[model samples]
Target: WLVKKTPDRYEVKIPARIFHEYVAFMRARINKGMGVAEDAIWSAATECLFLTSSARTKKDIEDNIEREVIGKTIGKFRNKYRSALRYGILDSAPDIDVLLLAKEIDAAVVANDFGIQKWAEELGVRFVPAKTFPLMLKEYLKQRSSISHSTKSDFFDDFEES
Candidate 1:
């Protein structure tokens, strides 16, 4: 049986507390890297990252620089993409929203918070630590682009090796 090709789009849900940091980190890495265009980076981030915030989490962002980056990246994407930001009434704290959204979307949750991770695991949701999520995403994007363009029979094998 032939395995299906990788889908062009994927989503990751995150808490609002981590949202600002994640966006900032991703934007910096994409900007510093060569080949990947800024437009495509934003598109990827918007499509892949899921975020829901409580008012408290939104208020906790203290650094102006970080807030600015978040605003420019996630904030702009929300306005431009419209549907990328998922908003709903919370039955609990905003942190749980990560797990809730992940389950809702059938997507992975990228978070550093222990509480979120624990709850996510209990719910049988896929979870990735925040520290490594950026690298994983970058690799995912690379593989996705390759699959779209590569005709090599061993492309998947080569990707695994690299």
Candidate 2:
């Protein structure tokens, strides 16, 4: 079976948190002289869109506290157990940023955070496990290299015949 080629326009959207995590992981691999890590880093540099979400403003802090404390308290009294339980699932500003950026760009999220994965699914965003990202990048780069090599060989063959 033939596999479809990845589109040239395909882009990877990454939040700052994931970007840092990926960079650190790749750096370690690169220091060890892993060829796949080299390819992955190059791909990330070219295809990944690194984005930073806004900082948690005063209002956001207040809202979080309200949700964690007052909301949970009210939820328990009102028999809304699920709402109370949801308070800490997305515990940080960076987590929310990942969801927001993915939703805005209609891109898949690569993150290990279970909370992010759960919420991404709820928002109809695609999710890719962080663990497999490097492997995927390696495969993509291999395919790209093979295609380029074949194209170059075919060009040389045509030139020789002419």
Most TM-score-accurate candidate: 2
Give candidate 1 regions above 4 Å deviation: 1-92, 152-162
Compared with the true structure, what per-residue lDDT tens digits does model 1 show for residues 1-162?
A: 999876553345455557545545654554444224445655454433323323244334345634465447765554544333222212234555666678889999887666667767877899899999999989999999898777564787788899
Residue-level lDDT for 37 in candidate 1: 43
Candidate 2, residue 16: the lDDT equals 62
Model 2 Cα shift for residue 39 (angstroms): 50
Error of model 1, residue 116, in angstroms: 0.6
**Superposed Cα RMSD, model 1:** 23.0
Using all chains and alpha carbons, the TM-scores for the candidates as numbered come to 0.36, 0.45
The local lDDT score (0 to 100) that residue 139 gets in candidate 2 is 99
Q: Model 2 — TM-score against the truth?
A: 0.45
Which pairs clash (backbone N, Cα, C closer than 3 Å) in model 2?
A: none
